[model samples]
Target: MNKIERIRELVEELNKAAIAYYKYDSPIMTDKQYDDLYDELTSLEKETGYILTGSPTQKVQGDVVDNLEKVDHKYPMLSSNKTKDLDVVRIFISDKDAIQSWKLDGLTVVVEYRNGELYKAVTRGNGTVGEDVTHTFKHCVNLPVRLRKPVDITFRGECVIPWDTFERINFELLEPYSHPRNLAAGTLRQLDANIAIERKLEYYVFDIVDGFDSGNLIGDYAYASDLDMPVVEHCAVRDLGEDFNKFNPENFRLPVDGLIYRYDDTEYGKTLGTTSHHPLNMLALKWQDQLYETTLTDIEWNTSKTGLINPVAIFEPVDLDGAITTRATLHNVSYIEDLELGIGDSIMVYRANMVIPKVHENLTKSNTWELPDKCPCCGGEVKIHNENGSKTLHCCNDGCQAKLLSRLTHYVSKNALNIDGFSEATIEKFMELGWLSSLSDIYTLQDHKNEMKVLDGFGNKSTEKLLTAIEKSKTTTLGRYLYGLSIPLIGRTASKSIGKYFKGDYSKFIEALENAFDFSQLEDFGDTMNMNIHRWYVKYSNVEDAYIPKLLEFDTPKFDSIVDNSSDLSGKVFVVTGSLEHYSNREDLVAVIESLGGKVSGSVSAKTSYLINNDSLSNSSKNKKAKEMDVPIIMEKEFLHLIGN
Candidate 1:
């Protein structure tokens, strides 16, 4: 096909893939293949000067960014709450020292107001940056579209798709979105803002990011209650002190995943910094969905790696966690036959992480079960393998689909390829498209550019981006790729150690592995791990033979940017005590110290840099700590200047 024709075809495929994967959770391409194909299509389009109308390359999933300019928020509303049950939330609230409340089910947005005029509105996209939805915001029902009174203000709020109206919608023109969150996200990004107006989305204001008088405002959250504007509810706590009423009139509306807690005093807020993922102020209470028991009637054997035979229980339908339970994965064949479980045995099952249930025991042991003599998937004859004299059934067929899925999962996990934008949906898509089987197929996606565009969400541009991402990934740290290869027990830390020893030279490592050299000779190499790695390389020789060449062809990632010292304030602790200025934000300052491996203290002690005062010099516990410890007090600017990032 000509380049233009090829580009057009690929875009169509990508569109289909996007729809199926995003909307249906059924996908047809692996992220790796998709990335490669996407890259090729983009190159083709650029070469042919032909971008299709239905191209994902031209748009971001049927939505286009607005023309409005971005305005920096004087205050950033870090995201909050991610739970569904009120019982757990109630328990958390009962235990918390203090709490605030608001609607949990709304699209969070930041609104900019200058001199009391509504100027702009932005939707929270990825927590850091947001989409400009000013025009759509004007059409939203709850927002006045114009201010009721004149005041210089820049505030944040949430716009939600209410459950009632959300359920009522049954339009022929609308997409059959599975949830309100999806519908709301799609609506806010509509090309015609008027279409968003038809959706009945509403807004509720909360934090004030910036305004003319914002600088002079005290940190009293209750004062916002009297400002004649909708404010999100939250209470400050001196401690998880004397458990206070966290739930008030303001608490019920939000559809929350969990509750949020912040130090009430601005001075206290400053002392607490952030972790890599969360701020020190908040503690998230995840609702644990545990497993419950049901009667087990039958057992099914599943063969896995290391030839361990697993027994699954067929049980009476019962509810455990959220979903109804019908089966539990029996860890081993011995586990099943050992239970003496029969056709009418009562059994117990439980779920952890709400993912899987385990068949613990048969309450009523009716009779024993027999082991299957044949492989379930391929009908291959099964053999009894004696592991340390304990017998387990093994299927000679090593290419079972279920087993492959589990193996592939390990290959693409966080420790492995570390391929960004790869989701389980994408993996299924790649397998369905017949573009992959073994790991090496990951390197050959560029040849299938024409097929990828036909899938949903892949356009010439997107495909190009994916391919770019893949190619960029070709040079990741050697440890990541090695870990990704599913080399048995070669964990991420071990792989890093090996990669550093070889300086990311996979060929040398592969060669050394092939020879079965004495690993005791290698420094810091454990005998068990060395033997394990060597055994893995030998057993998967065919795979290793193919993989090493691919590695040799790609660029290697380095560990050169290592920072070993937090020398600036090492052994000394620091607490943030008040509102920060001069530093870009709390995250930036914390990140700087953390990058150097320095520790940040949540509570004050003897070792502290000086409690930072954001509250125009307030006396707080952190301040007292600084005084008692003879720590030097500093401001945000001074810290920033000291660090000199």
Candidate 2:
């Protein structure tokens, strides 16, 4: 093919390659080849002004993602111009004054507050359309669901879970998370609103997305922290004329694909006109880092407990993003076959999202291919498991290395049954030395005295400590036991309720839970939770087979007070209108109110609660809700008084 055909072919190929790389995690092109083809295409477009119908040059803006609804912003979300040279940043800023701030970690969210209460929270989907996630934001107690005053404003902020929280949760479990950002993102997408509330997700309001300003005010963008608005951090700076050094974009929290430079004067912002796709005044600077290439040594298939096999490319370790990366996830079996990838093949790699180093392009001047016929760890026969056109390779071995300790830990996690002392590190090390095999074998520790001592680090004390910890944990709390059981769809809270409905007896719990399956028998369980309970209970058969007997000793805490199976707030919704006197914060109050079977309202409507209004008289809207619905008007203290603390 000639140059035009070649360019067209390459662009289509690269776009497919990008979709696999970004959208599907099945990368075909190496970074160098993608950059080369992209750069070549750019040069061709610039040289002849012949832009291909679908050239990457025009679409090199952001990663294509899923689980996100494309929502347009009131203001268009634009891509940034990137550079690695700090000197260039200094020059860019020196031309005008600027400020540097610690980039916060988490998800980018747009929240709208109406009449002082939070109206809605949305994800930054495509900078246009976004996913509505007010429910997922239940964890953000720091941000009052209803504001203290009537303020019709749209605020832009990041939804972040602390790195410390992420690490702490993963400390004992095997397969600790790679980063906190992905976890936060996944957590925010959970279907359960109650789960989000329990996750402790925080939102820091940054830019006022929409509000009537007295005048153009950028510096006038007041810090909420100064107002003691439950804020944790803030910063302020002004740009100096072209004399200072360039800024480093890497310094901020929460990973930034780029940075935004806006006029301190909102009026100056209004003055700067817009381009077809971007604003002329507000510039988003992207990061440009150098990349490298390498030859793949091995295609290691790592299977997760969820049964997805991820292809890990083991290559010669080379530095990228300030660290040597020898292994990068090939994503899935389709990724393996799509690239026609094989051992000893040349490929290019680069940091995508500034964190995960991904394979970008393939370099092939000759024909050479190698595919594994057997599992690497157990030498078991492997086969591709496919569903709805998606594929993954699985080791037929029930006891494969991929099913090692980390998998076991996740299987029994608090989400599973929450067995204590079965952390990922300890389990993996035990398995690596051939000390443990199955989940049930974890309870049979004392029988292996000879084997435990033979292991390098193991002595008498460590062995006994493990055994003693296990022994002491016989009577686990209902929630922990249920979550730790590794039952499908049965989380900690769900497990506890199941346990309680059965009077803390394991046998009764198993019988009722299994009977609840079959769909027709399930009235107490919600429709969405139907399949989960069915899959878990049906894993085995017979009343005895379903119940794990003498599995361990355990005890549960009993509630001293009465629990109303029929809730007072069963269908009634409530919105806390002001600062609560009896409850220290909205969260404590929301929890108690919700536990009583009440649905909390975010905005005032015909359906509302006492408003729990401390300033209910001063607040016209709260009063309006009471009048419109003829709802009872009660004070926070009065509500607590009726509850009789």
Candidate 3:
């Protein structure tokens, strides 16, 4: 292709990849491939002195929407220049003292503090302007609302969701987020601050945009640290090789796209001029991906409990990041269309973040492909539904076996029934053996104890343990039973809300359902959720052979006695971290706090009244945030004393 044509093609490809990665949270191309093409385009722009308006080399910004107010940034958030070449990195540093940190793969946000309180939080949009997200960011996991020093300053950082929170949220979502970055971005832009808070988004300050100056970058970081600001992990590196070896992204809990290197001398670094797209003070280094060629065997459609059918690509086994990889997720119909994927086509695959196998490219673009018209598990009618400009396949049959199996699996999950020994695989085996069909069938497993004992991977002791667990589960609380029902959009938290609202009386819940009571009036409850509960009870209860009533007979539900709401800790939020000395465990401490009319949150925020940690002086993120917010940290004994225990 000619130079101009190549430039156009590169821009189109890179823009598409960026859209997928940033907007959709789904990536069609590997990071290495995109960087290589972007570098080539940069080289062309430099040689010909002709930059296309759409070229990614000029400027790349997040999507601008009308939902949030737009504000101009005091300092333009310029993109960092990146290189995978070690030689280039060496040349840039040139024996100068530098700080190296992870380039967290998430939304870049700038938070301004005025009079020791958070004034504004804005996204990095188009370098010059940004969307105001202060309201939502107030609930960010480690974001301190009040600083120790009454300083007027603006600092830049990345907002992200940790992998654990991402995974837990995805488990309850019908269409899971492709990456934590997208989840964090979507959460930050949410209209409801409660939703953002539930996702547990975190912010790590990286650079002082227009804040208190100490003449040196490291000195500024130390100042910020004294204020207990949550900062990105960084180290002074004299040798690149030693530092790079020590800095492994795999060991980090957060998602990191690359490594960032910045000069420690702030004034000296500022003397170096900047390009239109990037600053000379800092550079990013992305990992080179190792792609493996493989052949597509077939596409498998797995129908989830929500009826959404997901496509999994089965391919010839290839070693990737020390594991044998054979399958990768094709996010949606649009993804398949973009790749033009087909059975028997030559494809390239790679591992993302040294984990999670992904398809990079389809070398053989055989456009001939067919989507299954029937559900693979139950041969039910399949249909396509479009929402938010995305097309997704779904199974029309609600009673499909695949959906039932998924629901059954969730019903017995740890957060639900707390049923031990009955895993999804074991449930599948029981279903295949005709010993299980519905949720009620689980209670009757004792009848098939003999048959199960002789089955594969099961013996007398295993069967006895399973039956004992089932018997013990009959004493579950109302929240567990409600969560176990698998009501649409009703998760553990919502179930707890319902259980507490009705005071854990199954009869009261039934009365509310029969009377068509407005559940939306409750905090955090919506019309859809209310409708879902009503519809579910009506559908299942009217049947003569209903499982709800039968299951209720087995459960001995319990509720907490109403506590005086005038307690000192009432309505206060507490964050518990580290080991406890006075209590048996964290859960015991949380139970006590809840009984005293106080709330327990997984993350620390400005709303928190206290942080309960035995190690009050520990430098954990929660402890740091508590210290920054001026929230008192109390040991277990101190907490108990405050509660008058």
List TM-score per model, in order: 0.45, 0.47, 0.51
| Highest TM-score model number | 3
* lDDT, candidate 3, 1-645, per-residue tens: 357656766776787777666555566666676778789998998888878765787776344443565566778888899999888888888889989999998889999999888988988866777778888998987866689899888889999999889889989988777678778888888999999878898989899888688988788888888777889999987668777888898788998989999999999889997877788999998987888899998988899976789998899998775557788888777678889998999999987543356687999999677988899888989998864445789987766778878888888787677778889999889888877666778888899989988998999999999998787666555667788878877877678777667655678888888798999887557677899888787766655553123444443444332333344567898878887555434544665577567888655667889888889779987788888889999888787668664
- Top candidate (lDDT): 3
lDDT of 1 by residue, 1-645 (tens): 346546755786676655543433333433323444566776787887877655655544321132333233334445332343445355544543444434344466777766566776776543444556777777777665345557666776777676556666644436454445556656776668878878887666544555433221234343343444555555544444333345532344433333454434334444666533244544444333334667766777765533345677788988653446687656455456667778777776665312335565678877666778787765776787654434567766555544554555566565465555656677668867777665556667778777776779787876776666565556455566777765655666567667655554566676787677665455445666688877766566554343132333334443222232223555555566565554333433454454444566544556555566665356775676567777778776666555552
Pick by TM-score: 1 or 2, better one: 2
lDDT of 2 by residue, 411-506 (tens): 445344344555777788877656566555566677886777666676787777767655544534444555555554455446545544443455
Better of 2 and 3 by TM-score: 3
Q: Which order, best to worst by TM-score?
A: 3, 2, 1
**Model 1 stretches astray by more than 4 angstroms:** 1-97, 102-160, 169-229, 233-254, 257-263, 272-375, 379-486, 489-533, 542-645
Per-model C-alpha lDDT, please?
0.56, 0.57, 0.78
Q: Total clashing residue pairs per candidate?
A: 62, 48, 0
**Which whole-number lDDT from 0 to 100 does residue 139 have in model 1?**
76
**Candidate 3 weakest ten by summed lDDT:** 557-566
